[model samples]
Target: MEFQQTGELEEDVWFDDVDPMLLEPSNNLKQRKLSVALVDEEGTDGLTKHVAVDCEMVGVGYKGQESILARVSIVNEFGKCVYDKYVKPREKVTDYRTDVSGIKAHHIQSEAVLRKLLALAMRDIQGQMPISRTFQYLKKEIYFSMTFKEFKDAYEPCKKQVEGIFLLGPLMDKVTDFRRWEEFQDVQREVADIFKDRIIVGHALSNDLKVLFLGHPRRKVRDTSDYKPFRRLNKGSKPSLKKLAQVILNKTIQAGQHDSIEDACVAMKLYMLNRKEWERSNKSKGVLKQTKYFCTNDSKSIKDEKRRKIKIFKIRNLQKKRR
Candidate 1:
Protein backbone atom coordinates (compact mmCIF):
# COMPACT_ATOMS: atom_id res chain seq x y z
CA MET A 1 0.00 0.00 0.00
CA GLU A 2 1.17 3.51 -0.80
CA PHE A 3 2.14 5.84 2.01
CA GLN A 4 0.01 8.94 2.17
CA GLN A 5 1.79 12.25 1.72
CA THR A 6 1.20 13.90 5.09
CA GLY A 7 3.83 16.65 4.67
CA GLU A 8 5.38 15.66 8.01
CA LEU A 9 8.82 14.13 8.52
CA GLU A 10 8.64 10.68 6.91
CA GLU A 11 10.15 8.97 9.94
CA ASP A 12 7.50 10.40 12.23
CA VAL A 13 4.71 8.86 10.20
CA TRP A 14 6.19 5.85 8.44
CA PHE A 15 7.21 3.99 11.59
CA ASP A 16 4.24 4.20 13.90
CA ASP A 17 4.96 1.00 15.77
CA VAL A 18 8.51 1.90 16.79
CA ASP A 19 9.09 1.15 20.43
CA PRO A 20 9.06 4.06 22.87
CA MET A 21 12.54 3.07 23.96
CA LEU A 22 13.70 3.83 20.43
CA LEU A 23 12.37 7.37 20.49
CA GLU A 24 14.66 10.22 21.34
CA PRO A 25 13.62 13.74 22.32
CA SER A 26 14.95 14.89 18.98
CA ASN A 27 17.25 13.73 16.22
CA ASN A 28 20.02 15.93 17.57
CA LEU A 29 19.97 13.99 20.84
CA LYS A 30 19.78 10.51 19.32
CA GLN A 31 23.27 9.30 20.14
CA ARG A 32 23.12 10.45 23.74
CA LYS A 33 19.72 8.89 24.25
CA LEU A 34 20.62 5.60 22.55
CA SER A 35 23.14 4.53 25.18
CA VAL A 36 20.74 5.21 28.01
CA ALA A 37 17.72 3.60 26.38
CA LEU A 38 19.65 0.51 25.42
CA VAL A 39 20.79 -0.01 28.98
CA ASP A 40 17.32 0.53 30.41
CA GLU A 41 15.35 -1.70 28.05
CA GLU A 42 14.13 -4.85 29.72
CA GLY A 43 16.35 -7.89 29.15
CA THR A 44 18.87 -5.81 27.20
CA ASP A 45 21.33 -4.58 29.82
CA GLY A 46 24.47 -6.43 28.75
CA LEU A 47 23.30 -6.86 25.16
CA THR A 48 23.90 -3.23 24.19
CA LYS A 49 26.90 -4.41 22.18
CA HIS A 50 24.70 -6.29 19.72
CA VAL A 51 22.51 -4.71 17.05
CA ALA A 52 20.71 -6.22 14.08
CA VAL A 53 20.42 -4.52 10.72
CA ASP A 54 18.49 -5.18 7.53
CA CYS A 55 18.08 -3.51 4.17
CA GLU A 56 15.23 -3.32 1.68
CA MET A 57 15.96 -3.03 -2.03
CA VAL A 58 14.32 -1.64 -5.13
CA GLY A 59 15.10 -2.65 -8.68
CA VAL A 60 17.24 -0.04 -10.39
CA GLY A 61 19.16 -1.28 -13.44
CA TYR A 62 18.37 -3.81 -16.17
CA LYS A 63 14.74 -4.87 -16.07
CA GLY A 64 14.62 -4.28 -12.31
CA GLN A 65 16.80 -7.33 -11.59
CA GLU A 66 19.62 -5.32 -10.01
CA SER A 67 18.87 -4.48 -6.39
CA ILE A 68 19.80 -1.14 -4.90
CA LEU A 69 19.31 -0.26 -1.28
CA ALA A 70 16.16 1.80 -0.78
CA ARG A 71 15.61 1.45 2.93
CA VAL A 72 17.64 0.32 5.95
CA SER A 73 16.64 -0.44 9.53
CA ILE A 74 18.53 -1.18 12.72
CA VAL A 75 17.05 -2.79 15.81
CA ASN A 76 18.55 -2.88 19.28
CA GLU A 77 18.96 -5.89 21.54
CA PHE A 78 15.35 -5.75 22.63
CA GLY A 79 14.01 -5.56 19.08
CA LYS A 80 13.47 -1.81 19.08
CA CYS A 81 13.95 0.20 15.91
CA VAL A 82 16.88 2.48 16.59
CA TYR A 83 17.32 3.74 13.08
CA ASP A 84 15.31 3.53 9.86
CA LYS A 85 15.50 5.65 6.77
CA TYR A 86 14.37 5.48 3.17
CA VAL A 87 17.31 6.27 0.93
CA LYS A 88 17.26 7.97 -2.44
CA PRO A 89 18.81 5.58 -4.94
CA ARG A 90 21.78 6.81 -6.99
CA GLU A 91 20.15 5.58 -10.18
CA LYS A 92 16.60 6.03 -11.34
CA VAL A 93 14.48 3.32 -9.79
CA THR A 94 13.03 1.00 -12.40
CA ASP A 95 10.77 -0.90 -10.06
CA TYR A 96 9.51 -0.01 -6.61
CA ARG A 97 8.99 -3.73 -6.02
CA THR A 98 6.12 -2.75 -3.76
CA ASP A 99 4.96 -6.36 -3.48
CA VAL A 100 8.29 -7.45 -2.04
CA SER A 101 10.09 -4.29 -0.94
CA GLY A 102 7.04 -2.35 0.22
CA ILE A 103 8.44 0.73 -1.49
CA LYS A 104 5.80 2.81 -3.17
CA ALA A 105 6.22 5.25 -6.06
CA HIS A 106 5.41 8.20 -3.80
CA HIS A 107 8.26 7.29 -1.43
CA ILE A 108 10.86 8.29 -4.05
CA GLN A 109 8.85 10.79 -6.11
CA SER A 110 9.01 13.40 -3.36
CA GLU A 111 12.81 13.34 -3.44
CA ALA A 112 12.79 13.62 -7.23
CA VAL A 113 10.53 16.65 -7.11
CA LEU A 114 12.61 18.26 -4.39
CA ARG A 115 15.83 17.70 -6.34
CA LYS A 116 14.36 19.32 -9.47
CA LEU A 117 13.04 22.24 -7.46
CA LEU A 118 16.42 22.71 -5.74
CA ALA A 119 18.20 22.72 -9.10
CA LEU A 120 15.85 25.42 -10.26
CA ALA A 121 16.41 27.33 -7.05
CA MET A 122 20.17 27.03 -7.46
CA ARG A 123 20.03 28.39 -11.01
CA ASP A 124 17.96 31.34 -9.83
CA ILE A 125 20.55 32.15 -7.13
CA GLN A 126 23.36 31.99 -9.74
CA GLY A 127 25.97 30.44 -7.34
CA GLN A 128 26.04 33.69 -5.32
CA MET A 129 24.07 32.33 -2.35
CA PRO A 130 24.89 29.50 -0.02
CA ILE A 131 22.84 26.31 -0.53
CA SER A 132 21.39 26.71 2.96
CA ARG A 133 19.97 30.10 1.92
CA THR A 134 18.44 28.55 -1.19
CA PHE A 135 16.94 25.72 0.87
CA GLN A 136 15.44 28.20 3.36
CA TYR A 137 13.92 30.22 0.51
CA LEU A 138 12.24 27.12 -0.90
CA LYS A 139 11.10 25.90 2.51
CA LYS A 140 9.71 29.25 3.58
CA GLU A 141 8.66 30.96 0.34
CA ILE A 142 8.04 28.55 -2.54
CA TYR A 143 6.76 25.55 -0.55
CA PHE A 144 3.83 27.62 0.74
CA SER A 145 2.51 28.05 -2.80
CA MET A 146 -0.54 25.80 -2.95
CA THR A 147 -0.25 24.54 -6.50
CA PHE A 148 2.44 23.71 -9.08
CA LYS A 149 1.08 26.52 -11.26
CA GLU A 150 1.38 28.87 -8.31
CA PHE A 151 4.97 27.74 -7.73
CA LYS A 152 5.84 28.31 -11.37
CA ASP A 153 4.19 31.75 -11.35
CA ALA A 154 6.04 32.79 -8.16
CA TYR A 155 9.41 31.64 -9.47
CA GLU A 156 9.06 32.78 -13.09
CA PRO A 157 12.81 33.53 -13.18
CA CYS A 158 13.43 29.77 -13.14
CA LYS A 159 10.84 28.88 -15.78
CA LYS A 160 13.48 27.78 -18.25
CA GLN A 161 15.24 25.66 -15.61
CA VAL A 162 11.95 24.00 -14.65
CA GLU A 163 11.01 23.22 -18.25
CA GLY A 164 14.47 21.79 -18.95
CA ILE A 165 14.65 19.68 -15.79
CA PHE A 166 11.14 18.36 -15.11
CA LEU A 167 8.14 17.33 -17.14
CA LEU A 168 5.40 19.61 -15.84
CA GLY A 169 2.56 17.20 -16.56
CA PRO A 170 3.91 14.24 -14.61
CA LEU A 171 4.76 16.15 -11.38
CA MET A 172 1.69 18.37 -11.42
CA ASP A 173 0.01 16.47 -8.58
CA LYS A 174 3.09 15.26 -6.70
CA VAL A 175 4.25 18.37 -4.85
CA THR A 176 5.47 17.15 -1.48
CA ASP A 177 7.72 18.20 1.39
CA PHE A 178 11.25 17.48 0.17
CA ARG A 179 12.63 18.28 3.60
CA ARG A 180 12.98 14.66 4.67
CA TRP A 181 15.35 12.63 2.56
CA GLU A 182 18.66 10.78 2.80
CA GLU A 183 21.22 10.30 0.06
CA PHE A 184 22.54 6.74 -0.38
CA GLN A 185 26.08 7.64 0.68
CA ASP A 186 24.96 9.52 3.79
CA VAL A 187 22.89 6.55 4.86
CA GLN A 188 25.84 4.24 4.29
CA ARG A 189 28.03 6.36 6.57
CA GLU A 190 25.35 6.44 9.24
CA VAL A 191 24.92 2.66 9.08
CA ALA A 192 28.65 2.18 9.35
CA ASP A 193 28.82 4.39 12.44
CA ILE A 194 25.98 2.53 14.13
CA PHE A 195 27.75 -0.77 13.45
CA LYS A 196 31.13 0.34 14.77
CA ASP A 197 32.36 -1.92 17.59
CA ARG A 198 29.06 -3.75 17.68
CA ILE A 199 28.20 -7.33 16.84
CA ILE A 200 25.96 -7.30 13.75
CA VAL A 201 23.14 -9.79 13.57
CA GLY A 202 21.20 -10.47 10.40
CA HIS A 203 20.17 -13.08 7.88
CA ALA A 204 22.25 -13.07 4.69
CA LEU A 205 24.10 -9.95 5.81
CA SER A 206 26.84 -10.18 3.16
CA ASN A 207 24.52 -8.73 0.53
CA ASP A 208 23.50 -5.91 2.85
CA LEU A 209 27.10 -5.06 3.72
CA LYS A 210 28.08 -5.23 0.04
CA VAL A 211 25.36 -2.83 -1.01
CA LEU A 212 26.28 -0.42 1.77
CA PHE A 213 29.92 -0.65 0.60
CA LEU A 214 30.97 -1.38 4.18
CA GLY A 215 32.37 -4.41 5.92
CA HIS A 216 32.30 -5.76 9.46
CA PRO A 217 34.97 -8.00 10.92
CA ARG A 218 33.80 -11.54 10.21
CA ARG A 219 34.26 -12.40 13.89
CA LYS A 220 31.72 -9.73 14.85
CA VAL A 221 29.10 -10.80 12.32
CA ARG A 222 26.32 -13.23 13.29
CA ASP A 223 24.54 -14.12 10.10
CA THR A 224 21.64 -16.50 10.59
CA SER A 225 22.23 -17.88 7.11
CA ASP A 226 25.71 -18.97 8.20
CA TYR A 227 24.65 -20.46 11.51
CA LYS A 228 25.34 -24.18 11.54
CA PRO A 229 22.16 -25.23 13.34
CA PHE A 230 19.99 -23.22 10.99
CA ARG A 231 21.85 -24.68 7.99
CA ARG A 232 21.32 -28.19 9.34
CA LEU A 233 17.59 -27.58 9.31
CA ASN A 234 17.81 -26.99 5.54
CA LYS A 235 20.04 -30.02 4.84
CA GLY A 236 23.25 -27.98 5.07
CA SER A 237 22.07 -25.39 2.54
CA LYS A 238 21.89 -21.72 3.44
CA PRO A 239 18.31 -21.15 4.48
CA SER A 240 16.23 -18.12 3.66
CA LEU A 241 15.43 -15.72 6.51
CA LYS A 242 11.75 -16.40 6.08
CA LYS A 243 12.30 -20.17 6.31
CA LEU A 244 14.54 -19.88 9.36
CA ALA A 245 12.13 -17.56 11.12
CA GLN A 246 9.28 -19.98 10.61
CA VAL A 247 11.18 -23.15 11.50
CA ILE A 248 13.43 -21.95 14.31
CA LEU A 249 11.54 -19.08 15.87
CA ASN A 250 8.09 -20.59 15.26
CA LYS A 251 7.20 -17.21 13.84
CA THR A 252 5.90 -16.34 10.40
CA ILE A 253 7.45 -13.28 8.78
CA GLN A 254 7.59 -11.74 5.30
CA ALA A 255 4.02 -12.81 4.66
CA GLY A 256 3.69 -9.90 2.27
CA GLN A 257 6.31 -7.29 1.66
CA HIS A 258 9.50 -7.51 3.69
CA ASP A 259 9.82 -5.09 6.58
CA SER A 260 13.42 -4.42 7.50
CA ILE A 261 12.49 -3.72 11.12
CA GLU A 262 10.69 -7.04 11.47
CA ASP A 263 13.46 -8.95 9.75
CA ALA A 264 16.09 -7.33 11.94
CA CYS A 265 14.11 -8.11 15.05
CA VAL A 266 13.78 -11.74 14.03
CA ALA A 267 17.51 -12.00 13.45
CA MET A 268 18.31 -10.46 16.82
CA LYS A 269 15.83 -12.74 18.53
CA LEU A 270 17.39 -15.79 16.90
CA TYR A 271 20.86 -14.73 17.92
CA MET A 272 19.75 -14.12 21.49
CA LEU A 273 18.01 -17.49 21.70
CA ASN A 274 21.08 -19.38 20.56
CA ARG A 275 23.75 -17.03 21.89
CA LYS A 276 25.39 -19.47 24.28
CA GLU A 277 25.64 -22.43 21.91
CA TRP A 278 26.65 -20.23 19.01
CA GLU A 279 29.38 -18.52 20.98
CA ARG A 280 30.71 -21.81 22.30
CA SER A 281 30.86 -23.33 18.82
CA ASN A 282 32.69 -20.33 17.41
CA LYS A 283 35.14 -20.37 20.29
CA SER A 284 35.85 -24.10 19.90
CA LYS A 285 36.46 -23.66 16.18
CA GLY A 286 38.85 -20.73 16.86
CA VAL A 287 36.76 -18.51 14.63
CA LEU A 288 38.73 -15.43 15.68
CA LYS A 289 42.06 -16.82 14.47
CA GLN A 290 40.51 -18.36 11.36
CA THR A 291 38.71 -15.14 10.47
CA LYS A 292 41.87 -13.07 10.91
CA TYR A 293 43.84 -15.37 8.61
CA PHE A 294 41.14 -15.61 5.94
CA CYS A 295 40.55 -11.87 5.90
CA THR A 296 44.19 -11.14 5.03
CA ASN A 297 46.65 -11.92 2.16
CA ASP A 298 48.01 -14.90 4.06
CA SER A 299 44.94 -16.98 3.20
CA LYS A 300 45.49 -16.50 -0.55
CA SER A 301 49.16 -17.51 -0.25
CA ILE A 302 48.23 -20.60 1.74
CA LYS A 303 45.63 -21.59 -0.87
CA ASP A 304 48.21 -21.27 -3.64
CA GLU A 305 50.73 -23.33 -1.65
CA LYS A 306 48.12 -26.08 -1.13
CA ARG A 307 47.38 -26.19 -4.86
CA ARG A 308 51.14 -26.49 -5.62
CA LYS A 309 51.51 -29.40 -3.22
CA ILE A 310 48.51 -31.19 -4.74
CA LYS A 311 49.96 -30.77 -8.26
CA ILE A 312 53.37 -32.13 -7.16
CA PHE A 313 51.72 -35.12 -5.48
CA LYS A 314 49.82 -35.93 -8.68
CA ILE A 315 53.00 -35.58 -10.80
CA ARG A 316 54.95 -37.93 -8.48
CA ASN A 317 52.15 -40.54 -8.63
CA LEU A 318 52.16 -40.38 -12.44
CA GLN A 319 55.97 -40.90 -12.59
CA LYS A 320 55.78 -43.91 -10.26
CA LYS A 321 53.02 -45.49 -12.38
CA ARG A 322 55.08 -44.93 -15.58
CA ARG A 323 58.18 -46.53 -14.03
Candidate 2:
Protein backbone atom coordinates (compact mmCIF):
# COMPACT_ATOMS: atom_id res chain seq x y z
CA MET A 1 0.00 0.00 0.00
CA GLU A 2 3.03 2.24 0.25
CA PHE A 3 3.99 4.35 -2.77
CA GLN A 4 7.53 5.52 -3.39
CA GLN A 5 8.12 9.25 -3.13
CA THR A 6 9.35 10.34 -6.51
CA GLY A 7 9.80 13.74 -8.12
CA GLU A 8 7.02 12.82 -10.56
CA LEU A 9 4.18 10.44 -9.84
CA GLU A 10 3.37 7.77 -12.40
CA GLU A 11 -0.28 6.80 -12.95
CA ASP A 12 0.44 3.08 -12.85
CA VAL A 13 2.49 3.38 -9.68
CA TRP A 14 -0.07 5.55 -7.93
CA PHE A 15 -3.10 3.50 -8.95
CA ASP A 16 -1.48 0.08 -8.96
CA ASP A 17 -2.51 -0.26 -12.60
CA VAL A 18 -6.25 -0.27 -11.91
CA ASP A 19 -8.53 -1.04 -14.82
CA PRO A 20 -9.95 2.11 -16.37
CA MET A 21 -13.38 0.51 -16.60
CA LEU A 22 -13.41 0.25 -12.82
CA LEU A 23 -13.29 4.03 -12.47
CA GLU A 24 -15.53 4.97 -15.40
CA PRO A 25 -18.95 3.62 -16.20
CA SER A 26 -19.86 2.47 -19.68
CA ASN A 27 -23.08 3.64 -21.26
CA ASN A 28 -23.62 0.22 -22.73
CA LEU A 29 -24.92 -2.08 -20.04
CA LYS A 30 -23.38 -5.17 -21.61
CA GLN A 31 -19.92 -3.68 -21.28
CA ARG A 32 -20.29 -2.84 -17.61
CA LYS A 33 -18.90 -5.34 -15.14
CA LEU A 34 -19.20 -5.44 -11.38
CA SER A 35 -15.78 -4.82 -9.83
CA VAL A 36 -16.42 -6.53 -6.52
CA ALA A 37 -13.53 -8.42 -4.90
CA LEU A 38 -13.33 -10.78 -1.98
CA VAL A 39 -11.61 -9.60 1.18
CA ASP A 40 -8.85 -11.74 2.68
CA GLU A 41 -9.99 -12.51 6.19
CA GLU A 42 -6.48 -13.52 7.28
CA GLY A 43 -4.94 -10.41 5.73
CA THR A 44 -6.71 -8.21 8.26
CA ASP A 45 -5.22 -10.04 11.24
CA GLY A 46 -2.03 -7.98 11.37
CA LEU A 47 -2.95 -5.14 9.04
CA THR A 48 -3.96 -1.61 9.89
CA LYS A 49 -7.49 -1.35 11.27
CA HIS A 50 -8.46 1.51 9.01
CA VAL A 51 -11.13 0.88 6.39
CA ALA A 52 -12.29 3.42 3.84
CA VAL A 53 -15.91 3.72 2.74
CA ASP A 54 -17.85 5.61 0.09
CA CYS A 55 -21.47 5.76 -1.00
CA GLU A 56 -23.19 6.61 -4.26
CA MET A 57 -26.70 8.04 -4.12
CA VAL A 58 -29.73 8.11 -6.37
CA GLY A 59 -32.40 10.79 -6.37
CA VAL A 60 -35.58 10.00 -4.46
CA GLY A 61 -38.65 12.06 -3.43
CA TYR A 62 -40.12 15.00 -5.30
CA LYS A 63 -38.30 16.25 -8.39
CA GLY A 64 -35.22 14.18 -7.55
CA GLN A 65 -34.04 16.66 -4.88
CA GLU A 66 -33.58 14.17 -2.03
CA SER A 67 -30.65 11.77 -2.19
CA ILE A 68 -30.81 8.18 -0.94
CA LEU A 69 -28.14 5.53 -0.77
CA ALA A 70 -28.16 3.32 -3.83
CA ARG A 71 -24.68 1.82 -3.53
CA VAL A 72 -22.00 1.53 -0.83
CA SER A 73 -18.39 0.34 -1.06
CA ILE A 74 -15.86 -0.38 1.65
CA VAL A 75 -12.17 -1.02 1.12
CA ASN A 76 -9.74 -2.48 3.62
CA GLU A 77 -6.32 -1.11 4.54
CA PHE A 78 -4.86 -2.79 1.47
CA GLY A 79 -7.49 -1.12 -0.74
CA LYS A 80 -9.34 -4.31 -1.50
CA CYS A 81 -13.10 -4.20 -1.68
CA VAL A 82 -14.50 -5.92 1.36
CA TYR A 83 -18.12 -4.90 0.94
CA ASP A 84 -20.08 -3.57 -2.01
CA LYS A 85 -23.82 -3.71 -2.55
CA TYR A 86 -26.59 -1.85 -4.28
CA VAL A 87 -29.41 -0.76 -2.01
CA LYS A 88 -33.07 -0.61 -2.86
CA PRO A 89 -34.29 2.74 -1.61
CA ARG A 90 -37.33 2.81 0.68
CA GLU A 91 -38.81 5.63 -1.33
CA LYS A 92 -39.28 5.32 -5.07
CA VAL A 93 -36.27 6.51 -7.05
CA THR A 94 -37.22 9.47 -9.21
CA ASP A 95 -33.81 9.70 -10.80
CA TYR A 96 -30.94 7.27 -11.19
CA ARG A 97 -28.45 10.08 -11.89
CA THR A 98 -26.67 7.78 -14.29
CA ASP A 99 -24.35 10.55 -15.42
CA VAL A 100 -23.04 11.07 -11.90
CA SER A 101 -23.98 8.06 -9.80
CA GLY A 102 -23.51 5.51 -12.59
CA ILE A 103 -26.51 3.66 -11.22
CA LYS A 104 -29.00 2.68 -13.88
CA ALA A 105 -32.45 1.13 -13.58
CA HIS A 106 -30.99 -2.34 -14.07
CA HIS A 107 -28.50 -1.85 -11.25
CA ILE A 108 -31.28 -2.22 -8.65
CA GLN A 109 -34.39 -4.36 -8.53
CA SER A 110 -37.30 -2.42 -9.96
CA GLU A 111 -40.87 -2.53 -8.68
CA ALA A 112 -42.06 -4.21 -11.85
CA VAL A 113 -39.45 -6.93 -11.52
CA LEU A 114 -40.32 -7.41 -7.86
CA ARG A 115 -44.02 -7.71 -8.67
CA LYS A 116 -43.36 -10.17 -11.47
CA LEU A 117 -41.27 -12.37 -9.23
CA LEU A 118 -43.88 -12.14 -6.47
CA ALA A 119 -46.66 -13.07 -8.80
CA LEU A 120 -44.81 -16.13 -10.03
CA ALA A 121 -43.99 -17.20 -6.49
CA MET A 122 -47.55 -16.70 -5.30
CA ARG A 123 -48.92 -18.67 -8.23
CA ASP A 124 -46.70 -21.58 -7.31
CA ILE A 125 -47.71 -21.53 -3.62
CA GLN A 126 -51.42 -21.08 -4.15
CA GLY A 127 -52.33 -23.17 -7.15
CA GLN A 128 -55.31 -21.66 -9.07
CA MET A 129 -55.70 -19.09 -6.31
CA PRO A 130 -57.93 -16.11 -7.06
CA ILE A 131 -56.21 -13.01 -8.50
CA SER A 132 -57.52 -11.02 -5.51
CA ARG A 133 -55.87 -13.45 -3.08
CA THR A 134 -52.66 -13.49 -5.11
CA PHE A 135 -52.50 -9.69 -5.03
CA GLN A 136 -53.21 -9.77 -1.30
CA TYR A 137 -50.35 -12.22 -0.77
CA LEU A 138 -48.04 -9.86 -2.60
CA LYS A 139 -48.81 -7.21 -0.02
CA LYS A 140 -46.20 -8.54 2.47
CA GLU A 141 -48.79 -10.64 4.37
CA ILE A 142 -48.07 -13.85 2.44
CA TYR A 143 -44.63 -14.32 4.01
CA PHE A 144 -46.37 -15.06 7.31
CA SER A 145 -48.25 -18.03 5.86
CA MET A 146 -45.59 -19.49 3.57
CA THR A 147 -43.06 -21.88 5.01
CA PHE A 148 -39.46 -22.13 3.78
CA LYS A 149 -40.20 -25.19 1.62
CA GLU A 150 -43.22 -23.57 0.03
CA PHE A 151 -41.30 -20.32 -0.56
CA LYS A 152 -38.39 -22.17 -2.13
CA ASP A 153 -40.78 -24.13 -4.36
CA ALA A 154 -42.41 -20.86 -5.41
CA TYR A 155 -39.02 -19.25 -6.06
CA GLU A 156 -37.70 -22.09 -8.20
CA PRO A 157 -39.76 -21.24 -11.28
CA CYS A 158 -39.19 -17.54 -10.81
CA LYS A 159 -35.46 -18.15 -10.70
CA LYS A 160 -35.57 -19.93 -14.04
CA GLN A 161 -37.53 -17.08 -15.58
CA VAL A 162 -34.92 -14.63 -14.26
CA GLU A 163 -32.16 -16.74 -15.79
CA GLY A 164 -34.02 -16.80 -19.11
CA ILE A 165 -34.35 -13.04 -18.98
CA PHE A 166 -30.63 -12.77 -18.50
CA LEU A 167 -29.94 -14.99 -21.51
CA LEU A 168 -32.03 -12.67 -23.65
CA GLY A 169 -29.12 -10.18 -24.13
CA PRO A 170 -27.74 -7.11 -22.29
CA LEU A 171 -29.84 -7.79 -19.18
CA MET A 172 -28.20 -11.19 -18.69
CA ASP A 173 -24.75 -9.66 -18.55
CA LYS A 174 -25.72 -6.52 -16.70
CA VAL A 175 -27.92 -8.00 -13.99
CA THR A 176 -26.04 -11.22 -13.24
CA ASP A 177 -24.15 -9.45 -10.46
CA PHE A 178 -26.96 -7.28 -9.18
CA ARG A 179 -27.01 -7.30 -5.37
CA ARG A 180 -29.83 -5.47 -3.67
CA TRP A 181 -31.24 -4.92 -0.19
CA GLU A 182 -34.85 -5.91 0.42
CA GLU A 183 -35.13 -3.42 3.26
CA PHE A 184 -33.08 -0.25 3.45
CA GLN A 185 -32.87 -0.61 7.23
CA ASP A 186 -31.09 -3.96 6.83
CA VAL A 187 -28.29 -2.21 4.95
CA GLN A 188 -28.07 0.49 7.59
CA ARG A 189 -27.70 -2.02 10.40
CA GLU A 190 -25.12 -4.09 8.49
CA VAL A 191 -23.06 -1.01 7.62
CA ALA A 192 -23.20 0.21 11.20
CA ASP A 193 -21.92 -3.15 12.38
CA ILE A 194 -19.08 -3.17 9.86
CA PHE A 195 -17.93 0.28 11.02
CA LYS A 196 -18.59 -0.22 14.72
CA ASP A 197 -15.07 -1.25 15.72
CA ARG A 198 -12.92 0.05 12.87
CA ILE A 199 -11.37 3.35 11.96
CA ILE A 200 -13.28 4.71 8.92
CA VAL A 201 -11.51 6.74 6.27
CA GLY A 202 -13.43 8.68 3.66
CA HIS A 203 -14.02 12.03 2.02
CA ALA A 204 -17.11 14.05 3.02
CA LEU A 205 -17.96 11.15 5.31
CA SER A 206 -20.53 13.26 7.17
CA ASN A 207 -22.86 13.10 4.17
CA ASP A 208 -22.58 9.32 3.99
CA LEU A 209 -23.12 8.96 7.76
CA LYS A 210 -26.13 11.28 7.58
CA VAL A 211 -27.81 9.17 4.93
CA LEU A 212 -27.01 5.93 6.77
CA PHE A 213 -28.39 7.43 10.04
CA LEU A 214 -25.34 6.18 11.91
CA GLY A 215 -22.54 7.84 13.81
CA HIS A 216 -18.97 6.90 14.67
CA PRO A 217 -16.79 8.39 17.38
CA ARG A 218 -14.76 11.30 16.00
CA ARG A 219 -11.55 9.61 17.08
CA LYS A 220 -12.22 6.66 14.77
CA VAL A 221 -12.90 8.76 11.69
CA ARG A 222 -10.25 9.88 9.20
CA ASP A 223 -12.01 12.18 6.75
CA THR A 224 -9.73 13.38 4.00
CA SER A 225 -12.06 16.23 3.18
CA ASP A 226 -11.80 17.60 6.72
CA TYR A 227 -8.06 17.05 7.15
CA LYS A 228 -6.20 20.34 7.70
CA PRO A 229 -3.37 19.46 5.33
CA PHE A 230 -5.77 18.49 2.55
CA ARG A 231 -7.80 21.64 3.18
CA ARG A 232 -4.64 23.69 2.68
CA LEU A 233 -4.12 21.97 -0.68
CA ASN A 234 -7.42 23.44 -1.81
CA LYS A 235 -6.61 26.97 -0.59
CA GLY A 236 -8.21 26.51 2.88
CA SER A 237 -11.62 25.40 1.65
CA LYS A 238 -12.86 21.81 1.86
CA PRO A 239 -11.27 19.94 -1.02
CA SER A 240 -13.15 17.51 -3.24
CA LEU A 241 -11.94 13.92 -3.45
CA LYS A 242 -11.51 14.33 -7.17
CA LYS A 243 -9.22 17.30 -6.63
CA LEU A 244 -7.22 15.49 -3.98
CA ALA A 245 -6.73 12.44 -6.19
CA GLN A 246 -5.63 14.66 -9.07
CA VAL A 247 -3.17 16.75 -7.07
CA ILE A 248 -2.01 14.40 -4.36
CA LEU A 249 -2.12 11.07 -6.12
CA ASN A 250 -1.35 12.51 -9.55
CA LYS A 251 -4.19 10.54 -11.08
CA THR A 252 -7.55 11.49 -12.52
CA ILE A 253 -10.82 10.30 -10.97
CA GLN A 254 -14.52 11.02 -11.34
CA ALA A 255 -13.98 12.13 -14.93
CA GLY A 256 -17.37 10.79 -16.01
CA GLN A 257 -19.30 9.02 -13.27
CA HIS A 258 -18.53 8.43 -9.61
CA ASP A 259 -17.54 4.93 -8.52
CA SER A 260 -17.70 4.20 -4.79
CA ILE A 261 -14.88 1.63 -4.92
CA GLU A 262 -12.58 4.06 -6.69
CA ASP A 263 -13.44 6.82 -4.28
CA ALA A 264 -12.96 4.56 -1.28
CA CYS A 265 -9.59 3.43 -2.60
CA VAL A 266 -8.51 7.04 -3.15
CA ALA A 267 -9.45 7.99 0.41
CA MET A 268 -7.64 4.97 1.81
CA LYS A 269 -4.54 5.73 -0.23
CA LEU A 270 -4.53 9.29 1.02
CA TYR A 271 -4.78 8.09 4.59
CA MET A 272 -2.05 5.47 4.07
CA LEU A 273 0.29 8.05 2.56
CA ASN A 274 0.14 10.06 5.76
CA ARG A 275 -0.85 7.39 8.27
CA LYS A 276 2.02 8.04 10.68
CA GLU A 277 1.81 11.82 10.69
CA TRP A 278 -1.99 11.69 10.86
CA GLU A 279 -2.00 9.39 13.87
CA ARG A 280 0.70 11.41 15.64
CA SER A 281 -1.13 14.68 15.02
CA ASN A 282 -4.39 13.26 16.36
CA LYS A 283 -2.59 11.83 19.38
CA SER A 284 -0.99 15.20 20.16
CA LYS A 285 -4.42 16.82 19.98
CA GLY A 286 -5.72 14.27 22.53
CA VAL A 287 -8.35 13.03 20.08
CA LEU A 288 -6.90 9.54 19.52
CA LYS A 289 -8.88 7.81 22.26
CA GLN A 290 -8.89 4.02 21.91
CA THR A 291 -12.54 3.44 22.62
CA LYS A 292 -14.86 1.24 20.56
CA TYR A 293 -17.99 3.37 20.75
CA PHE A 294 -20.37 5.13 18.43
CA CYS A 295 -21.61 8.69 19.06
CA THR A 296 -25.23 7.74 19.52
CA ASN A 297 -27.27 8.77 22.55
CA ASP A 298 -30.41 6.91 23.47
CA SER A 299 -33.71 8.80 23.57
CA LYS A 300 -33.82 8.76 27.37
CA SER A 301 -30.27 10.07 27.66
CA ILE A 302 -31.02 12.86 25.18
CA LYS A 303 -34.15 13.88 27.07
CA ASP A 304 -32.29 13.84 30.39
CA GLU A 305 -29.53 16.06 28.99
CA LYS A 306 -32.09 18.49 27.58
CA ARG A 307 -33.92 18.73 30.91
CA ARG A 308 -30.64 19.21 32.81
CA LYS A 309 -29.69 22.13 30.52
CA ILE A 310 -33.12 23.69 30.86
CA LYS A 311 -33.00 23.45 34.66
CA ILE A 312 -29.55 25.04 34.75
CA PHE A 313 -30.80 27.87 32.50
CA LYS A 314 -33.78 28.48 34.88
CA ILE A 315 -31.47 28.52 37.93
CA ARG A 316 -29.21 31.09 36.25
CA ASN A 317 -32.22 33.28 35.48
CA LEU A 318 -33.45 33.04 39.13
CA GLN A 319 -29.98 34.01 40.43
CA LYS A 320 -29.88 37.06 38.09
CA LYS A 321 -33.34 38.17 39.28
CA ARG A 322 -32.23 37.86 42.95
CA ARG A 323 -29.11 39.98 42.24
**All-Cα superposition RMSD per candidate:** 19.2, 16.2
Clash counts per candidate, in order, are 0, 1
lDDT of 1 at 48: 65
lDDT of each: 0.68, 0.68
* RMSD from true fold, candidate 1: 19.2
lDDT of 2 by residue, 108-144 (tens): 7664564455445544755576545644555342223
Candidate 1 regions off by >4 Å? 1-47, 111-179, 290-323
Query: For candidate 2, which ten residues in a row score worst on lDDT?
Result: 166-175
For model 1, residues 1-323, the per-residue Cα lDDT tens digits are 14577767665444465433333222221112111222224554333689998999898655787677888989888888889888877766778788898876445556555566555655667567764564456655334425545554544444344455633433334345344458887998888888888889998987787567676788888898887667665655678988867656667789998999889988888788788888998898887555441133244434554575577579789999999
Per-residue lDDT for 309 in model 2? 55
Q: Give the lDDT of residue 260 in candidate 1.
A: 90
lDDT of 1: 0.68
